[model samples]
Target: MLYRIFTDKEAFEEALYSYQTNLSIILAALLLMPFNYLMEVFKWQLSIKSLTYLPFKQATAGVLSGVSLGFVTPHAVGDYFAKIWSFSHEDRKKALGPILVARMSQMIPTLAFGAVAFIVFIQRKPVFDDYSSDYTSWLIPVAGLIAFLLLSFLFIKYGVKNKKWMYYFDLIRKLQLKSVAQLVALSSVRYFIFSVQFMLLLSIFSFPISFQQQFLGIAFMFLAKSVLPTFNFFNDLGIREFSAVLYFETFDISAAPVILASLLLWLINIALPALIGLFFVPQFKIDPS
Candidate 1:
């Protein structure tokens, strides 16, 4: 992705010039990385508390390990195993429940905020004017609703009958309303941190949009990226750039800054943590016995 972007020599040069002058903004974005992941660690700590008491140090290590492994796997499925492996064999199955809860808590804000952003995005006549009459747009919502209902029916009728599946249902039942609310609150904080980091990176690149426009563009980009399917190899590479460019081009903003900001945000939030997590990766060992 970097190579592709750098191929456009003009964009590359502009980004470098921006970086040299806005060094402090770059530093600020980097500083937020710890707090972003720290929020995740706290979410992890709270999520697993229902099943086992994970100390702060161990939770931090486990969360980092999950990030490292998740970097290499589709949809970050490796994250679930990483957290589960942190427990004894006896507790591993139970751990799945909390791991899922932690994941869902994080996703709720993305979906909720993304839904609103999508609605607002479509209302922008400059972008959605042509698509206003398109039937395909209506098809997407109808299809989604049908699929959701079908899946819910199948899960209720068949999934609940499986003994192994009961673990997750039971775990959900065990969680109090307060704990669930706390998980959502912590996840919201993490989401806000990353969003601010993206905005900071944009400012560093001198994006010429108003604050509201920038926030809307960022929110829309995140929503599009989150809802789309991605293989692990391509997860952080192209989707974000495409989404940002697609949204901001309407405002006559240059693609260079938008693309660079998205890429830099990925580096600070995802790539950097994955590098730190490499240290803890070797410590995770699965027992076959």
Candidate 2:
């Protein structure tokens, strides 16, 4: 599976050779990765503010630590525990709920944009047209997707709960709308930054496709990667690379540049954070309290 997903080493080398030598694009993307983490740290700080007055420095530590631990765990849900490691013994138990609330809030933008990207993919890709010659036939799925996303976002925004639900999620139940909004906003901004970064990398590598084509492909690629669960970090990349090929090939975008861009993204965003996060991980001890 690894070989199949990440094959064509020669081709990737060629793509890297053409693009990586350009120092400017590489430097810009490398620089942007930290801002990406900073936005997330702020989002997390807001999420936990009501529960406890976690300092900005501590929050940054927690978020980066979570990133490192999350990289190894399935779906990175390990972050659920990793972020709370920094809190006081009493607050650690209470912190889980707000952390989950922050996570779900971020998911809203992913679902919304992902649904739109899927719609775009279906509309523009010839494969969809080939799958159904009738123009009206596609509307059924498109409309369904739009409706599903709308309902999903609505649920996220105003989901209901009774005392029973709150009983299990005591800290999470304390969540306020303002914090959720901040998280959603942060997540969206981070999404836009990375998506633009991917586009810039593609241009650097000279992927032969229009801006709209590249946008749609990367948008759907992210959507698919987020929704699909994976067992390990490498598996996460496998899913990303596979989706890139699936989405970009429709636009006649070659696998080489997309793969190289995906690799760069993983390196600067995932690998770097995870390594930086490791230094902070030792700052907290695991105390569930």
Q: RMSD, each candidate, Å? A: 4.8, 4.1
Work out candidate 1's RMSD over C-alphas: 4.8
lDDT of 2 by residue, 36-97 (tens): 88888888888777667878888889898888898888878767777877767564566666
TM-score of 2: 0.83
Q: After superposition, how far is residue 214 of candidate 2 from its true place, in Å?
A: 1.5
Which ten contiguous residues of candidate 1 have the minimum total lDDT?
A: 149-158
Q: Please, what are the lDDT tens digits per residue for candidate 1 over residues 1-289?
A: 4455447788768777987899899899999999998898898888777677888888888898888888889988878878877655565667776776677667666766565456556765332345655545544654564355345434543467566777665565576668878988898899889889989988875556577677768877877777788876635578888888877777777778788789889888888888888898777778665
Error of 1 at 5 (Å): 7.5
